[model samples]
Target: MSPSASFSDVVRDRRAVRSFLDKAVPDDVLRAVLDEAQLAPSNSNTQPWIVHIARGTARDRLSEALLRADDEERYSLDFPYDGSAYEGAYARRRQDQAKALLDALGVSRDDEAGRRLAARRNLEFFGAPQVALLCVPGFAGARITADAGMYAQTFLLSLAARGLGGVAQTTIGFYADTVREALGLPDDHKLLFSMSFGYPDKRWTAQTPRTYRASLEESVHFHE
Candidate 1:
């Protein structure tokens, strides 16, 4: 992060970084960020988030496995996920977000091949140097899931604080089995999500749009 960045600056600047350079994050810096994220609050002080970070050769093999599993139409999701269940503003936002990405990359909606390739990039971690898979034990239910979300946000902010960037990948949970098998994780672990992070490639980062948030009135309410 910039030496002059305030808390609000970090919050405002943090976004899903879709592209990254080929450089690896130094170990000390990575540890400092994670250590800060560890302070995130959890339900009843029980931190249920299990983070598994992959880099170097291991990350490459995991990506290959994910792509193969996707090709075979095989999936073992710990939790269900589909973009279609939402409606109203939520649905509209999702559509707009998709279009923004496609447009930013100069991919036309009519180009099926190009669209597919663009979508496939998620599996490749957008060429990021590292990925973190967040998992919880099988027994963690809905309430703990909320705690996990908080943990993830803290992690993202921590990355931003360190001048790094990351995007949380829900699709990674769709390939939970492949990741678990490839990484030798316990069979009982439930993969909630994953993320790809690194120092962004400025060339590509310049091409993508920042994610926008809803207006305060649309999401917040108070009564006296």
Candidate 2:
């Protein structure tokens, strides 16, 4: 398919898959996806993305370590934007998302146990067979992060094109120090995000929701 059509189809079909089947993705296919992801443009062509793909024993070990860390204590997230500064529509949207998710999981607003259970699923990688960690230079500025975002979107779309699904997890970044120590990541590299990847479990009806997008006119403007 042409790049435009392929991109459009991939974007339309892509979803944040929470459950995955036991099947393993082929190495060549994964390599192709990475190749496509690297095609993403970067400032000054710095192309600053280092991806670590874990599978089998490595994947299991990392998952175990992450779950243990999460059990011990919640990690502190580094937010680019201050949540305390958010007001009005953005805050309402955030609250609505939380409510919708909790409702979908049949968890009441007061159900601490239910919330913990849902949070725990992230540590388990939602039962995905493979996980990819994206890292960047610790000293890299916001422009590098913007480049990383493009790479991530490209990676996710590539996965979707192959009938695989995944979630971009910034939560992993919250425990970057622990994760780096456990995984033996380079001192210069900082964990930006981790992604869980695998075929979706077809049995879950909860995964069927279609996400909506804002209209072009609402999201875009022209000065002329």
After the best TM-score superposition of candidate 2, give how far the Cα of residue 219 lies from its true spot, in angstroms. 2.6
lDDT of 1 by residue, 1-224 (tens): 33347889999888898899999999988888888879999989999989999999999999999999989999999998888898999999999998999999899999999998988888999999899999987898998899999989999988887788899989888999999999999988899989899997777777788768899999999999
lDDT of 2 at 203: 67
**TM-score of candidate 2 to 2 decimals:** 0.89
| Model 1 alpha-carbon drift over 4 Å, by segment | 1-4
| Tens-digit lDDT string for candidate 2 (1-224) | 21334767788768888788888888788888888988998998999988888889888888788888787885644335356776875576667766766776788989999998987888778889888888888787789888999999988888888878889887777777666766787877877888998888866535455545557886689997
- Best-fitting candidate, scored by TM-score: 1
Clashing pairs in 1: 1-163
Taken over the whole model, the C-alpha lDDT of each candidate is 0.90, 0.79
What lDDT would candidate 2 get against the real structure? Answer: 0.79
